[model samples]
Target: TIEMKADKTLSSVLSARAFNALMMVDFWNPIYSWRRAVLMQYVPGTASFDPESSRYDLEDAFITNVKKSGLYTQGDRESLEIQFISLLEVELEQHQKRIQAYLNHARDRLKTSEGLLGCLTLAESRR
Candidate 1:
């Protein structure tokens, strides 16, 4: 079913150059989604929305791009922002959990190494 849909979408952009152009559009769509997801979490607490600040600039650009997409024109800006932030909260929480797990793993490895060193020191003393 997906392959059939891809074929239908491909007909309009038949040549390699045309397909390349289409691919760029396809690639940025997910990138934009990811940017929106990340910015939604951080932008609200930021002190400055000035262009000089990279985070603010990114947030502004994402909002501007979404506006031009014409999909959420019916919703108020605040509503849209809240919706996006809530939509990705679970994903953000899961990301934090993953980072914590990695840290715990590192700590565990350090403890194991310390124990091995203690045992080696005892063996050397006995010898």
Candidate 2:
């Protein structure tokens, strides 16, 4: 079992978002496939792993770290918030595009399978 410390900034951010961690291990076993149990230790400020929230947090961390590193001109909190919102919008748009593409692919595959099934039925009827 490995123990890890959460980043102080991330801990503070998560605490501000109302996440308090209890010392526990979340067990996971795939109902249909896996029989082995996977144990995950819950650490403070790291209990939940929501991808969308994680993405936003990562962006926020990146912006703050970059600003602190003096790589870019530091903006006021309002401006930073605006920038973060814009970044989130862009990310959401990209995710939507990916979802649409996946749906289109599934639709195309269904069409192809239907066509193949029809051909097979016709062939079997003539046989």
Candidate 3:
């Protein structure tokens, strides 16, 4: 899991682009089959993990910290969440387009090489 700030600054964009490029390569030959991503705007306050307690408690603590940050009000939280979802959807669409373009280029190169090889074989046969 890669964690990054979603502020969309220059550094953030570069980091995301690098990560996306890595993911594209990994998609073809995966070192791991599954990739889980989490994007959050604000850093959460530190909390202690309790093996005895349920996961819900830990999650609640994190959420509480997010609210305490005062970056988003209740209404703003819903709007921001929707915006983030939209951003992710657009990013996925763009990534798919990039993958398709790469595949098409590779296929075209393969076809051209095969055609050239076939012509050479035909010339040799004629000789």
Candidate 4:
């Protein structure tokens, strides 16, 4: 009969709750989100870019920081513009829809206020 012997060591490490706490910060103002359409739609007229610098500097600041970090790179200037154009298009479309809705609401409010003012003016004239 041949005798066989084996030796082995096993270990395991598990971390169910190990975590790091981080504060979430958003650098954009709520009001700027509404007006960003104007900024994003164009790269601007006073841009300074050449062998000294690159074009993305002037236009890139307006993109939300998250998107800027995700989509931007030193080499992808044209791609950045294309992506900005698409994002700007979407933002502008949504802005237009919101503006239309606001205009409609304003029209309704104006009509109601005018009617009330007319009623008050007529009532005053009767006195």
TM-scores of the candidates in the order shown:
0.24, 0.25, 0.27, 0.29
Find the 10 residues in a row with the least total lDDT in model 4.
Answer: 18-27
Worst 10 residues of 3 by lDDT: 34-43
Overlapping backbone residue pairs in candidate 4 total 0
Give lDDT tens digits, candidate 1, residues 1-127. Answer: 0122222333321333322322232232433445345334433232233334322233344444444444445565554443442343344455456557866765675588786687578659756
lDDT accuracy of residue 24 in candidate 4: 6
Tell me the tens digit of each residue's lDDT in model 3 across 23-93.
55335434442321222433243433333541213334433444455443453644433333233334656
How far is 60's C-alpha from truth in model 2 (Å)? 9.4
Candidate 2 or 1, higher TM-score: 2
* After superposition, candidate 4 runs with Cα above 4 Å error: 1-47, 51-56, 62-91, 114-127
Clashing pairs in 1: none
Candidates 1 and 3: which is better by TM-score? 3
Candidates, ranked, TM-score: 4, 3, 2, 1
Q: Which lDDT values do the candidates have, in the order given?
A: 0.42, 0.36, 0.45, 0.36
Which run of 10 residues does model 2 get worst, by summed lDDT?
20-29
lDDT-based ranking, best first? Answer: 3, 1, 2, 4
Candidate 3 yields a Cα-based lDDT of: 0.45
lDDT tens digits, residues 33-89, model 2? 121121011112223334454422432443344344322345554342333323333
TM-score of 3: 0.27
TM-score, predicted candidate 4 vs. hidden true structure? 0.29
Worst lDDT run of 10 residues, candidate 1, spans 1-10
In terms of lDDT, the best-performing candidate is 3
**Best candidate according to TM-score:** 4
